[model samples]
Target: MSTYEASLASAAAFMERHERFLVINHVNPDGDATGSLLGTGWLLRQLGKQAVLVNEGSTPEKFGFLPGAEQIINASRAEKPEFDAVITCDCADFARIGDVKEWLPLGMPLLNIDHHPTNDLFGTDNLVRTDAAATAEVLYDLLTYMKQPIPQEMAVCLYTGLLTDTGGFRYSNTTPHVMEMASALLACGVEPAPIAERMLETITKAHVRLLQRALQTLVLRDTDQTAYLTITAADMEQCGAQNDDTEGLVNYARNIEGVEVGILYKEVASDKVKVSLRSRSIVDVAAIAQSIGGGGHVRAAGCTVHGTLADAKQIVEQKVSAALASQEASV
Candidate 1:
């Protein structure tokens, strides 16, 4: 009846055509990425298809409660396996697929299913819906159309994706339709408390130390409307925090009132910094990410910049400030 409805139908059509699937998401898979992979894996298996969840690194410990979480394989740990098709969920481009990008089945059908507007359309069948709140939203419609019953475990995974990507339904992307979809998942026995606990409450001691150290280094700009924190190798070792510990720290800056932009810079290696950007409103962080050779949604996005953390933080803050100022001028 509408464009999205037709698109949902097509996604269903694509699933029906495939018998075997290998699911991959972006590097350092977050709740949305991991949840999308798990939910899709469950749905595919329900249809008598073999679905293997593959990623560049280990699944975040926060998502261990999700269905099929243990089945997720590290592309670097074992030899890559061939599949009839490769499906990428929640990743905007091939580069974001990280180390596993090398193993992508060449000349085979690839499905790029996502909600980010900056998606590179790497899949033979590109199903990018920028209007949707989350990739999980797209999956919900497709699963319903395919007549696949959503089980409680699958519901937990989908709900985690929906919640985190939507900022616990507090972001601008949270629409009535998103709420309705979440309600449906809840009806399928998705409990908010434990899922929230698993996804939010489960934090490591190193993560807490990292958060403290990171906050100590925070710098504010744009008259305190923008805040950023940088983590160096020394900082990581001092706190005993790994790459995964850096999750959700950006929100600390974003949550401050009057702050329009928040940034977290993690020194992945010497002279290499991973920059994550977030905005409440009046800023399109994704555009900033694109300019710096990465892409994601408007409210939350990231890019890896080559240089010292200081260099990357300065560039990213300036870019985000310009975007925020431009939005202000327009108003």
Candidate 2:
């Protein structure tokens, strides 16, 4: 059997020993987190095991259509459901569990399933594949090994996660293996068009307005190669937009012909700014995020700064500029 098969067998055997499971994802979960959670939850239910999803925050409005989304309980509000084991999907580190960390019992078995190279392997059983394009790919293998059937709705959830996380297969991480996995999911009646439309093509008027406003603040530094945008709390209020509306704004900056990196700084709450970074080539945005107390992959990463938007933006831009300048000089 292949390594994936072996890992799947191991994970399945472990699950078979557990009666109750608490599932969790990282804070500010994206498509990968939600999709993997839903897919895994479906598989767990098929095995006749009790599973509960605990997320750090509310699912984005755009992804509310995913099946089993309503079953997710915010970790902060949950009454601490008792579980024999804990499973975290798509999270690199323990801190990413946010408030859900409080619910896990000490000395209890924890399973960490992820695709990030930065994963800490904090669980009793860890299956982190750095080569997988998305965590959904790993989940697909797990479901197969467990002899669980992938229903149409489960296919939708997995497909949605796979598509968005890989940037519709345009990202560098989209390998032939990922394409094969996508094909397998497609065989389960996955449709690409509507999924793309709903996740990427569809946009609300307020979201459009917010994008325009955020774009208007775009700034290019270091010979117009690094472009970024900043959105203050006032900007969100002015556009009547929520945090989810700014989801893909950083891509806009990264797509610019001369830009090497794109950054979006948004006021998430009082005295805190959420920063998203994207890099076209060469630059490792994850390193930048790590320097700012956040972590992700090389191409995409995010972190939050505990300061006013202006202060956070200034710090990020300055640090990013220095990093780009060093990269250029090295080249």
Candidate 3:
């Protein structure tokens, strides 16, 4: 069997042996992370396994429309359930799962399923497919291999993962295979319009206000090839924006003309900043994020710096400047 086939077989066997599972997603779960976790939970239920979905953070209100959103428990409320196995969805590394990792049973088998190229192979059965657009895509293939029917609810969850991770099919990661999977999900009764509206088009006043504050901090560097914006915790509070409200704000910086790289520096605490990076092309933000002990895809990645916002900005600015120079020199 091929490497992927072998990994899949091992993952399938691992799932088959486990009766109770703890499904964990990354902190500040995005659409792919949330959908993959919930979709996997649903798949496990279909197979007569008891699966509990938990995250370090709460599911954003916008994603609450997903079929099993209400079932996901926050880490604070979760008990150390008698789980036999732990499956991490859409997380590049164990640290991304945040505090929930502490609750896992010792020596339980870990199945790491993700699409990030920077995955560290943290699972006993690692299913990391860099070519897949989203972890949901990987899960779809795994479900097919396991002969688990993709119910409408699961289809909706999977489709949402595909949609959001690809930036509504606008990102470079949206390959032909991604489109094919989307078509299959649609055939499985996943409605595109409502999902698109909820995940993309809809926005609240608070989010808009937060965007305004973020936009005010936008800066251009490296001859306008790099653009970045900042959002402080105080700004989030003043705008009455939840942590999820800052989603997609970096797109504003990237959307600027001539800006190849867009970044968002968000102050999550007094001395901690979470940085989100996006690139149009020619730069691997994943490498940059990994250098700072974080990881994601080539075009999009993130890392957290434990320093004042000014210090984090200076450090990231230098890294981005050097990356842009290196990309230019190669050409």
Candidate 4:
């Protein structure tokens, strides 16, 4: 196993050796994934490498304001292009890259950059740093090591990554180094108020209606210490909302008073449902997610259950209830 530092050196070397790169991020990208993907693109361009940035799905509309976001191609529409290597950011496993994998040439070298501890280390060179607040933090170190300067556009991407992963710097992962990185990015001319407003404060009318529909389905379980919200296809279609509109809906349940666990169940199909898990205290939501074939940080994680919404709810509620009963669920 390559040490994180060793992988950093190797990843940088791989970037240097490659003249063209396919850069991607996880499916259903959040700010961290989108920012890291674009930030990596900017970084590669700084090294004079040609980077074709792709995402397994569309980036959230809120992130469209960031520099270079317009260039992100969805996998379904992306055509195969020759490249020296494939670099994925903020993805814990190869599966997270989704359909983008289909575009890669066989035996392509991969530089896996991420901050998830659950990362399978699937890259030829892995730079997984669990201590870092976000993947952008890892990129910041790489930029510093390469003696590269952070430009204004790059600052927007990196700063957005740090901001989102830390829940606007309110999550437990927000550390001193994360703060310093944000400070440096701010120094690079990242306007704090506008980005924060667009990212954290803004929501579309369609999303508001979506939220209205979701809240009506909200149910409090586990003696009101857990909150459950469901979003069905009917609601989505009626509201004219896309997956991006559902971005932070799970947080609504998670922020409720006395709610230690919040779970959102969204219908993916008649027989498939997507689950988002969040915790307010000691629960290891990531473990709960991984138990059912998904992964993410402890406070926030997600999984997909192959069943109707009711069936998925039954499974998730049981698991979350069990975890809450466990010692880890206690404050």
Candidate 5:
């Protein structure tokens, strides 16, 4: 059997062997992260397995439309349940799961279902397929292998994952297999237009103001091949914006003409900055992120650095500039 087939079989066996499970994703849960966590939980429930969906952070209001999102409890709110296994979706590293790490049973089997190229392979039974486009895609394959019927609710959740991770099928990772899975989910009674509208088109006034502030800091570097933006804590305070409001602001930088890479630096703490990276064509932002203790896919990645916003920006800009130079030289 192929590697993916073998991994699926192992994952299915692991799930079957366990009774109670704790499903988790990254801290700042996005559509893909939230969708995968909820989707996997719903699937396990269909199999009569007890699954508790937990996150270190709360679900954003934008994803309230998802079927099982309301059921997801924050890690702080969750009781210490007797969990037989732990499954993480979309999170590339254990640290991304935040406080949920402390809640897992010691030495319990972990099923790492993810698509990030920078995955740390931290699970006992890893089903990390970097080519899958989204962790929800990996879950869909696992469900099919286990002969579980995809319910409408699961379909909606998985479709949301595929839709958001691929930027609504606009990103380069939107492969034919991704489209096939999306089509299958659609056949399971998911409406794409509504999901797209809810995820992409609906933006709050605070988000608009945050975008405005971010755009004001947009800077072109590396001879205009790189575009970067910033969002200080002051900007968030002035606009009444939370981290959720800055979700897609990095795209504005990436969409600039002649720019191959985009970067967003957000001051998350007084002495720390969170950096999001996106690349258009050749630059592998994932490698750059991994080098600095972060992980993600080729086109999109992120990492946090300890320093002032100015210091973080200078460090990241130098790294990105070197990566660009290396790519150009190799070409």
Candidate 6:
């Protein structure tokens, strides 16, 4: 067996060894995180395991159609539950799961399933497949490896994970294998057009309004090949947009021709800003994010800066500008 196959076998054995599971994903859950969380929860329950799915926040409205999404609880660190093991999906590190660890029993076995290259291997049995396009992709492999059947609901959740994480199959990570997994998911009764429309084409009033305000703050660094935008707390308040509404806003900058790097600065508080970065090709945005105590994939990454929005913008601009320059120099 290959290394990934061996890891899959081991992870399957680990799952088979446990009966009760606590499932979780990262904070500020995205499509991949939420999809994998819901899919895994469904899989566990299907196997007659006692699984409690929890997230740091409520599932995004777009994903409410996902099967078992309503089952995800917004848990507190104070609620200690009995679990044989913890199954983390789409979380790069334990901290990304937020403070839910505080409620977990000390030294409880953790099975980390993720696709990020920056994964910490923090789980007792780590099944971190960085080469896979999404955690759902990894889960598909696991399901096949274990000879498990996929129901239509589980397929919807898994397909959503693959769809969003691959940027609707537009990102570089969309390989033939990724496409094959998606085909298999579709064969399992996932209606492709509807899911895509709901996730991509559908938008709320708050989203477009917030986009208008954020775009009004657009700034371009012509020399560095970067385009940027910012969303202030005031803008979000005025538009009544939640954090999820800002999901794909950064793509507005990255999608522009000639723009190599796109940045979004979201003011979470007066003294705190969340920075999202996207690069067309040349820049390793994840490394830039990691330099500022954040982490993510190569073309896309994010970090939270503890400073005023202006300070955060300055810090992120400096980082990406330097990175662009450095990569250009090396070339």
Top-lDDT candidate index: 3
What is the C-alpha local distance difference test score of each model? 0.85, 0.85, 0.91, 0.89, 0.90, 0.88
Tens digit per residue, CA lDDT, model 5, 133-158: 89989989998888888889999999
How does each model score on TM-score? Answer: 0.94, 0.93, 0.98, 0.96, 0.98, 0.96
In Å, residue 165's CA in model 3 sits off its true spot by 0.7
Worst 10 residues of 5 by lDDT: 75-84
TM-score of 4: 0.96
Worst 10 residues of 6 by lDDT: 74-83
Weakest 10 consecutive residues, lDDT, candidate 1?
Answer: 4-13
Off by over 4 Å in 2: 1-6
Q: Write the per-residue lDDT of candidate 1 for residues 199-308, one digit (tens) a residue.
A: 67778899899988888888888889998887788888888777888888988988888998998888988889998888887788888999999888888888999988
Q: Could you tell which candidate, 1 or 3, scores higher by TM-score? A: 3
Q: Is candidate 1 or candidate 5 better by lDDT?
A: 5
Q: What is candidate 2's lDDT per residue for 163-277, written digit by digit as tens? A: 9889888899998888988898899998888888898788787778878888788888878878888787888888888767788888888899989889888887779999999
In angstroms, give how far residue 265 of model 2 lies from its true place.
Answer: 0.6
- Write the residue-wise lDDT of candidate 4 on 1-331 in tens digits: 4476677788889988889999989998989899999989998888889999998877777888989999998878667777889899999888899988887777789999998867888888888898899999999988887788999999998998898888799999988898888899999999999988888888889889988988999899888889989999888899998888888899999999999999889998999999999999788898999999899888889999999998999999999888877764454
Error of 5 at 109 (Å): 1.6
* lDDT digits (tens) for residues 79-107 of candidate 6: 66688899999988788888787777779
The true-structure Cα RMSD of candidate 4 reads 1.8
On a 0 to 100 scale, what is the lDDT of residue 295 in model 3?
A: 90
Error of 6 at 159 (Å): 0.6
Candidate 1 vs 4: which has more lDDT:
4
Clashing pairs in model 4?
A: none
